[model samples]
Target: MTQYRNVILLALAQACFLATSMTMVTFAGLAGIAAAPDPKYATLPVTLSIVSTALTTAPMSIIMQRTSRRFGFRLGAAIGVLSALMMTYAVYSGSFILLCVGALMVGPFQSSAQYYRFAAAESVPADKSSRAISFVLIGGLVASFFVPTLWRFFGDLFEGVDYMGAFVFAAVVVACVFIPVAFLRPLEEAFDVGSDNAKEEDARPMGAIVRQPGFIVAVVNAALGYAMMSFVMTATPLAMEICRIGEASPEVIQQHVIAMFLPSLFTGFLIQRFGLFSILLVGHMAFAVAFMTALSGIEVMHFSVALIALGLGWNFCFVGGTTLLTRVHTQAEKGRVQGLNEFLVFSTTGVASFAAGLILNLYGWQTVNQAAFVMLVIASAITLVWGMAGQLRARRGRL
Candidate 1:
């Protein structure tokens, strides 16, 4: 019961963390356009946020390793409160540079929040880790609803400057997260970090770990899935506006966010039943569907359907990748391995997000979908080949 309670609280914290992150996703690019010196740099703030996360991933993991998860989480929540205030001031001051700086500061907060899944994994049995990870991510579904609704309701509170109200509301929501996070009591037995008897024999070097077929596949699935999803998602609103479908852009983004997380309700079960490789294959298939759907038309429905499929694809790949990662590294190596994985994943995403606006502005929406398709193909091919090799190795071991 205590374990489950901890997971629940982490989930709540995840919800608040996402509400801040997603709300930024919802409005950051548009706000950037309004504040940026050049329209081409409109998405820079969003990209910087992702870049900041990538940069801070390693340090945050190290902090958690040296301290307690609760301590780390509390630290992140405090930063989130500070970032929210910065965001409020950024919008109110009408400074694009300040907004970009605010976005940059929020990166550590989001990076810290990403550890919620790993923390949830720590609270449960090993076999149930996937479900625990998924359960924590399910909080994103609630965030998908709450964030946009929060934006819609409070977005206009400042009358002449609506983004200010949204940022202020985001600040309040983030402040509330500190409460749930402060009370969390993680299972002490799960972490093996401080024990003097910890065996060095079982732990492999980072190079050897990354060279493993499973590790490579896991990182590829996560990085490529995240990058492609961010690529399209970041550009979706801009593309919709280009298509003169701007009015529904917010709702479209909301639906896409929901789709990204809605699958968490059952993705872990599917991974357990079908195996991680199979689920990863299906995730690629989902991305393929999204690409095909995007190419089919430029209508609002087409964009909606494509983004929804993209969301489902991201959910499966990310969850599958994280699950696979757990099998590749031992307890002592988790901090380094997870930090490296996230750094790679968000670096890929940050680059893709920064390029998204440029691609949209230079080429068009079709080109963006085409770029996503290319990445999907590359990831799927690599994972499939790696899985086959692993199977062959397993067969030889059995014989």
Candidate 2:
């Protein structure tokens, strides 16, 4: 555990990041509705935030590769602080355009935060990678439980301005990320540009690396799984608004957030016990359950159950996929592979988030759930093929 000191600090940083994220996720859509000219554009701010994240992920990864993670993380926290202030002003002014811009500015911060799990993985031995990743994610669980109370306390600070103080609270929380980041020790595998070891572990061409079966499986599960999760989650606040349960949206989202991270407590252990493919399969099944429950009704219970399942599904697929990804890359290829992987994952996520609003407005909640099926099928098929191929190889090796 002492050796995991860096992992613990990274987790603290993750907690700060998630607290800010939860505040935004809980309030941003409602804020968008208040600011947007039309109801249909209510999720535009949220979508833009994801878009910004997608755009910055690869660049941030590359930047971290060249610089230290400590430097990169501090830079991200500073950006988050600025973005949070921009959002506070946006809310205060009721300016939809400014809100969108603020959300876009939040991308780089989120892009940096997303690497916390990867950094944790790199800090530990290969066998302990999954547990380290899970431990860092436990920060989200802590954030999920506390952020709402913090928001409520801050939300009341400015009497006339609705969520203005909450954004301020977000800024403060984001700034707190710097505290943990300050103490983060350099990772064991930190890239050194001119080192003999670095030169010897020469990276393969991007195409060759991405073409591996393990890489394909990893990306498919993580990318499509995240896309599906974003698709439904981005639309959820609006769906609740449509159902006239707007006031309950926060509680539902909180429950979903909790569900998303609580499983981290034992997910790494489950993966070790059940095997990666089994966990991925279960994740897909959980997603199926979420869609079916969502389609079954529009009541608060329906929303709660569906979102909980969605969170669980996301946890399983994302964790398993990330663990699988670590196996397919050398230390030299880490930056390129991780950068490309995140670029693809968040790119799809951005698309899903944007489309969630359009689809929810045009077709309805049912269509949003229905559309996710296509991605789920693709993810499941590839996972199945990969699992079977591994089994065949093992059998042949035994012969």
Candidate 3:
């Protein structure tokens, strides 16, 4: 129980972090619409937020390595609070540029929050790492429930100021992150082969580490899985609008968000029981089914089912990929490896999100789903080959 204290606190911190994010996602676009000079740039604030996250991910990871996770997280929480206040001021002043700047400032918080799962994994023994990762993600599930209520209670708290009070609420939520984080105990060092100096000496070059088949597969599943999820999820509302089911979009998206994090409740247990490769294969199949279902129809039922499948697929692949990554790096290499992994994952996600709108508008929803399907097939094939090669190597060793 004592050993698990950090995990519990981290989970609480994750919930607070995600609640702030969900609030921003819910209100940022509407605020942008009100403040922007041109209607076309209404989503620019959201885009800038993701861009800021991607740019800072690697640097934040390195910073945590030099300092400590507690320090880094507190710094991120401070940044989130400041950014939320800036956004509040932006709404009050109706300044589009200031809103964008505030959105950009929030990225470090997102980047830092992403490490909660990794930190959870670090809190537990290696065999239980998958469970720790999944448990931390349950925080997102909690946030999905918490955000709507928060809005209902405070949506109009500032009277004439529109979303100004909501942004203030976001700041308060982020500031609350300080409480649980302040209690987090320091994480133990990763297991290494020898003395600390020898461990440092044994660290492989980045190129050499990334060249490993395991590393490549981990990145493919995590990065491409995230990209596909973002691409499809982002396009869903727009696609529904075209299909004349736009009114149902919110319910469908709500269900999709629920599907995404609900499975974290048991995903780690499934991984522990059935193994990573099998779960990953199921994730690939889920994506395939999702794309096919979307292609088959545009009805509300079809959209709901497709998005649900998409979310489930993302959970499996993302969790599996993260677990796999932990097995590949040495203690000395943890910081750079995790940093590079995050950088690639979010970079692809940022590109996929930005492209989703363009591709859907230009080629239609069918084409967007088809492109994602094609990418998934390519990534799945690479993963399959890697898994089989790993089995063959084990067989040869036995012989």
Candidate 4:
């Protein structure tokens, strides 16, 4: 269908979005440190970006549902251009508060861009939904490859400001997505009933949807997976600097970003072959591995290995949880559920991001990893119980 072709275009657009996102993660904390009022709040900008994304999640979903996805995409990109420009001025003028505002504005752009995967799912058959979602995310591989390189290429574009060039280039990259969305046809909402014949009885209440076992597992895995990953990743650069591991900090982040998306290459196939439960279990295990490795030392190799594991874990949990969510919701419920899911996921991640610098400064690197380890264990335990309960129900049905 032509919608599939549109999906490809959206995927390209997703690549551009991820490129901007990765750059933010890579430099936002460091930038915050450069101009923050207090050194301890060095990650405040990054934390605010996440908090902003969380706040925008539901509103963006509502906008897409009421209008066209294309409209939301374009609106988001336009805002992105504004945000990037603000960031540019923020860095150039060395204004910390302005930088936070810019970061906060990025939330809407990210909130809209995140739906690319769901939009891809709408483009294909239900059976191929997971594959389509993965395909859209595969665009991140482009960002993974180019974001750090671009950061370096443009890091010194301004004579005195070190990172201002990066934001300038980021603005240009965000503008690139606008052109693709302009030429594309909007994908229709698949599950919602038309307003002409709308029936309140047909739509399930939010509480009912939230109570589903599958929904609980899906939200838990994705939210916690994201929170755990953000906790450690946000603090890595600062920790690297404290350890005097200068140039290698970006390299470590680059590797972590690459690892995060590389698995999207085959994750859909894994979901198909092994099933969501198995993949989720493995995802939790991957988080465990990352935490354990990080606790082992403060060496560059240790951080590198731990982040790689964290990346792999996030992919499996996030992708698997998202795909599983598709099975539970009807067309009408998509916007509501996805918005709530993203809000919870990003909000908790915001907390984790905010805590990262404080914990790293107050306690130590090992303590940060220790906290991540505890969260992972709880998430893993909950997932296991959910999976077992599902199996028991299946068995009872057979009997």
* CA-lDDT, candidates in order: 0.83, 0.86, 0.82, 0.85
User: In model 4, what are the clashing residue pairs, if there are any?
Assistant: 191-331
Q: How do all the candidates rank in terms of lDDT, highest first?
A: 2, 4, 1, 3
Which ten residues in a row are the worst by lDDT in model 1?
Answer: 186-195
lDDT of 4 by residue, 1-399 (tens): 676786788888999898888778877888888888887888888898899888987778678878878888888889988999998899888899999999999888988898888777876778988778777877777666777777777875564786797798879999999876776654643233245444456779999999998998899889989999999999999888888885677778878988899998888789999889999999988998998998888899998999999999999999898888888877667757877887788888999999999999889898999999888888888889988988999999999
Tens digits of lDDT, candidate 3, 33-140 = 689886446556776788899898877777787778887888899999999999999999999999999999999998889888878887788898877876787866
Could you tell me the TM-score of candidate 4? Answer: 0.90
Off by over 4 Å in 1: 1-3, 65-67, 121-133, 186-198, 390-399
Residue 150 displacement in candidate 2 (angstroms): 1.9
10 residues in a row with least lDDT, candidate 3: 188-197
Q: Which residue pairs of candidate 3 clash?
A: none
Off by over 4 Å in 2: 1-8, 62-67, 117-133, 182-202, 396-399
Point out the worst 10-residue segment of candidate 2 by lDDT: 187-196
Order of the predicted models by TM-score, top scorer first:
4, 1, 2, 3
Residue pairs in steric clash, candidate 2? none
Writing each residue's lDDT as its tens digit, candidate 1 over 1-399 gives: 877877888888888887787778767887777787877787888899999988987677678877777777777778877887887887877798888888898888888887888888888878988787777888766777756667777866776884787788878888887877777775322244443645666678889899988898999999999999999989988888778886687778888888988887888789879888799999999999998998899899999999899999999999899899989988778767887888899999999998998888888889999999899989999999987887898999999
User: lDDT tens digits, residues 1-399, model 2?
Assistant: 644988998989889888877777767877887898987787888888888988887778678878777777888889989999999999999999999999989989998998898788877888998789878988777777777777778878875898787799989989988887776666523454333555434888888888899999999999998999989988898899889997677778889888888987888789999999999999999999999999999999999999999999999999899899999988788767877888788888888887888899889999999999888999999999999999999999999
